[model samples]
Every structure is written in structure tokens, then in C-alpha cells.
Target: MNRKGAHLEGVFLDFPDLIGAYLNGTHLERTYFRWANLSNVDLANADLADANLEGTDLIGAKNLTIDQLSKVKTLYNAKLDPEREIALREKYPALFEKPDE
Candidate 1:
């Protein structure tokens, strides 16, 4: 399937309809999904850095963050408002890591 700009993290899930395209394993690397609905899906190893998921409906997607659910981020309507970035950055300070600090 031509995902326009959907990042198929390798696994093109073949299941029920109500959801967006399936992406289980495709070596996803910083892909953009402007408003894609990814509810209830496994996206481990998917590099979502700098990916613009504005207004994306991830109401049930699993593992958008890293490692375990504990690292979960930007899923199930993850407030993408421009103003939210400030708060998010404040909440997760480690995000601003120096490359060679």
C-alpha cells in the first residue's frame, strides 16, 4: 500500500479495517504522519524523532515511545498543540541531551 508519507516500520499489519495502515516491521526512520490514526499497534524500534504526528488519532496504539510502556509518549491523542511542546520539554528534561557533553 502507498502510505503517501506513512512510515511502515517494516511490519505492514494485515488485520481489521477501522485502523490506519499496519506497520509492525519496516525499518521505520523518522517518518511523518500528519493526522494518521494508529490505535492499538505495536511500534517498537520505530524511530519517530522529528516526526510530525499533529492531530494523529493514536487512541490505542501501543509502544510509541521506547523499550516498554513506561517510556510511552505521543499516543492516544498526544496533545500536539504548539503550546504543549513547552510543557512536554519541561516534563521530560533529558530530551535536551548534548551530543558530546
Candidate 2:
């Protein structure tokens, strides 16, 4: 699934298995990813602003920086590398907030 630079705003992806997908530079603003498996996905330069990532599996995701996660609406229950999760939580506590309606 190569969707580099694609505009996917406001899309709803429930439990989608997108492992190893290439989503670099994609526009994922306001997207809903509930319990989705995005492990090993390339998210370099992807715009995840206001995206809902509750219960989303991002473990081992490639090019996934804390800066990108900072812009997301929420990361509650999102699976990430232990160290990365700690760093993100310490740097951006608001991203762990409850999802917005």
C-alpha cells in the first residue's frame, strides 16, 4: 500500500492492517485509526494533525518522529516502542488525552 503524498483527510480506518505501508508525506489530518495495525509503516513527513490514533499499533513504525505524534489529536492506548512512548509522553502530554468528539 503505497500512498505517498496522498490526501486522506477525515478517513475512517477501523482495525486496518497497514503493516509496511508507505505513507510518506501523506495528508492524514483528522483521520480516524481505531485499533489499526500500522506497524513498520513509513510515515516520514506525513501530516497527522488532529488524527485519532486510539488503540492504533504503531510499534516499529518507520520515520515516525515525536514531532509528528505531537500534532495528532490523541494517542491513547496506541502501541509504540517503550522508549519512544516514554519520550513522547514526557515531551507532549496532551497527545495522550482523550479523543475529541
Candidate 3:
């Protein structure tokens, strides 16, 4: 299996924290979740293209695919692609861009 990540293209997503913040689907593409803790979070209908959530806790979050990992981040502020970010906003209307909500 090629990991089913052809649609996911990028290198900015390499860590877990950066991926968890934007669980609402606003940043980080193709993020691999190799043992991250995301317990009790609302992740319904989030877009997780190529994220690898091998061992993570997503009990409350709904609409989250088993193969999807929450990924998002910014050096100084919220940084996301124009298209992807916009899509995220449209996808997840319940949860805001930030995860700490």
C-alpha cells in the first residue's frame, strides 16, 4: 500500500503538536500521527487527507477518519494555505480554527 496519500503533498507537517492545534481542519497536510494524545476533542467532519494517527486518543471527536490526524500550526500566527484553509472553514463550522476552544 502507498499509504493512500497521493492527494497529500507537503513537508510542513512533521510533528504532532502542530497537527493537534488545528484538528478542526485548517492546517497541516499529510501529517503522520505517530503516538499523539488527542483525547476528548470535537473533530467531526475534519479533513485529514494523509495524516497517520497510529496511536492517538480521539474518543469525543466525531467525523474523524481513522486514517486522519489533527494537524495545524504557525510561526507567529495562524498560517494555512489559501485554498486548504478556506475549505477547512467550510468543512468544520462548529469548531473554530483553534483547537483549545
Candidate 4:
């Protein structure tokens, strides 16, 4: 689905199949995306602050950057491109921490 620039704050979307969706510039603050399939999705300029991204699949997601992931609530077990994952982990280790940790 194309939801570029849409305001989707605090939305719950666990386990959603959102492969290749266009979500660039979307406002996704505090959204719940646990275990969601967002592979190849376009997330340029998307606001993901305080969002739940545990176990979400972000492999090959377009326009995703370390700055974006840094603001997220968590990425525990989330799937991302190897290089990006390494970069994120190195720069923002807290984002990968479990809630109970």
C-alpha cells in the first residue's frame, strides 16, 4: 500500500505483510510493528520515534538510515541488511536492547 506522508502514529500492526509498501515520509511515531514484514518497503524520511520494531523484517528496506533507526524504541531481533545492522548496532546499541534488559 502507498501511504507516503500519512500520519500513522500509535498504530498497531503486528505480523503485517507490508512488503514493498511505500511509506516514505510517513509519521509512524510510537507505532507497533512487531514481527511485521516490511522488506523492501520505502521509508525515506519516515518518523519512527518510539516505535516498536521487535522482530520486524526490514531487509532491503529502501532509504532506511541509521539516523532513523536510532530514534526507535527497540529493534530486538529485527531483521535488517547486514551492513546496516552492523552500523546501527555499533552506533545505537540501546535500540537493540530487550525491554526487560
Candidate 5:
């Protein structure tokens, strides 16, 4: 679905399969996206500050730069593209910590 400029701040959206969705210019600040499938989704210009992305799959996502993800509050177990993951790893090492045996 294409929802450009949508205001979804502080909303709870779990386990949604939103592949290829157009979410540009959306206000997703502090939103909860746990276990959501957002692969290939577009997040250009989206405000995601303080958003919870725990276990969200964002592999192959579009228009999501390091600058944008840098503003996110939580990325625990979230799956991002390799490049973005590398950038985030430096800033949030806990995101990449190995699980205890």
C-alpha cells in the first residue's frame, strides 16, 4: 500500500507484511513496529525518531539512509541491510551483541 505523508506517530503495528509499501514523508515517530516485515518498503523522509523496531525486517528497504536510522530509538534484533547494519553497529553495539549460550 502507498501511504505517503501519513501521520502514524506513536501507533502500534506489529508483524505487518508491508513489503514494497510507500511510506515516504510519514510521521512514524515513536511508533512500534515489532516483528514487522518491511522489506523493500519506502521510508524516504519519514520521521522515525524514538520508533521501536524490535525484530523488524527491513532488508532491501528503500530510501532509508544511515542518517534516518540514526535517529531511531530502538533496533533490538531488527534486520537491516548490510550497509545500514554496519553503520548502526558502531553506534549501537548492543544491537549486534551475541545471545548468551
Candidate 6:
């Protein structure tokens, strides 16, 4: 629940269903989350630097800010809330690709 500095860097977590998991302050740098279901997950203060979120679903994810997502290495095809998507698109236009390629 309260995992501070949990190391999960560069791991393949493809298609994982981690909905509502508490991941506060977890070390997720460079982690690969291709198509992972992170809905409503708590990622407050989690180190997501260089994390790959390609095709990952981030809808309803809590405690995640645009700045945090911006610091990540990639976010191609990543799904986000409408408002958040708009904000991220403004900064990282390449992240939001058409047709989820």
C-alpha cells in the first residue's frame, strides 16, 4: 500500500491490471508499461523518469500530474483523461498519436 522507493525500473509489465494499487513514492524509472491498466492507481511522488508508457491506459489515475508525465521518456498511444490528454498534447504532441499505433 505505502511502498516508498519500490524498485521496478526497466521491467516488462505489459498488459498488467494494477487498478487502484497504491504506489506512492515507488521507483518506476525506465519501466516498460506497454498496455498496462493503471486506472485509479496512486502514483504520488513515484519516480517515473524515463518510463515507457506506450499504449498504457492512465484514465482515472490519481496523483499524477502533467509535469510528472512530461518527464517520462515515452508515452506513445497512452490513454489519459480528456483534460489531461489535452494538457499533455500541448507539451508532448508526439505522445498522442492517431489510431493508437
Best by TM-score: 4
* Model 5 pairs whose backbones collide: none
Stretches of model 6 off by over 4 angstroms after superposition: 97-101
Candidate 1, position 98, lDDT = 29
Compared with the true structure, the alpha-carbon lDDT of candidate 1 equals 0.43
What residue pairs clash in candidate 2, if any at all? none
Candidate 6 structure, TM-score to reference: 0.88
| Ordered list by lDDT, greatest first | 4, 2, 5, 6, 1, 3
Q: Quote each prediction's TM-score.
A: 0.44, 0.94, 0.38, 0.96, 0.89, 0.88
Tell me the spans in candidate 4 whose CA falls farther than 4 Å from its real position.
none
Candidate 4 local lDDT, residue 37: 97
lDDT of each: 0.43, 0.94, 0.39, 0.94, 0.87, 0.84
Report the C-alpha lDDT of model 5 over 69-92, residue by residue, as the tens digit: 877777788898888898889877
Q: Which lDDT value does model 1 have at 59?
A: 54
Order the candidate numbers by TM-score, best to worst. Answer: 4, 2, 5, 6, 1, 3
Judging by lDDT against the true structure, name the best candidate: 4
Clash counts per candidate, in order, are 10, 0, 5, 0, 0, 0
Model 4, span 1-101: residue lDDT tens: 99999999999998999999999999999999999999999999999999999999999999998889999999999999999999998898888888653
Task: State residue 3's C-alpha deviation in candidate 4, in Å.
Answer: 0.4
lDDT of 3 by residue, 1-101 (tens): 11221333343333344333334543335554444545434455455554444434444443454334223321112233344335545664322322321
Query: Distance (Å) between predicted and true CA of 23, model 1?
Result: 2.5
lDDT of 5 at 53: 84
lDDT of 1 by residue, 13-82 (tens): 2222326444544344434454565665555454554444444555555444433222332323343334
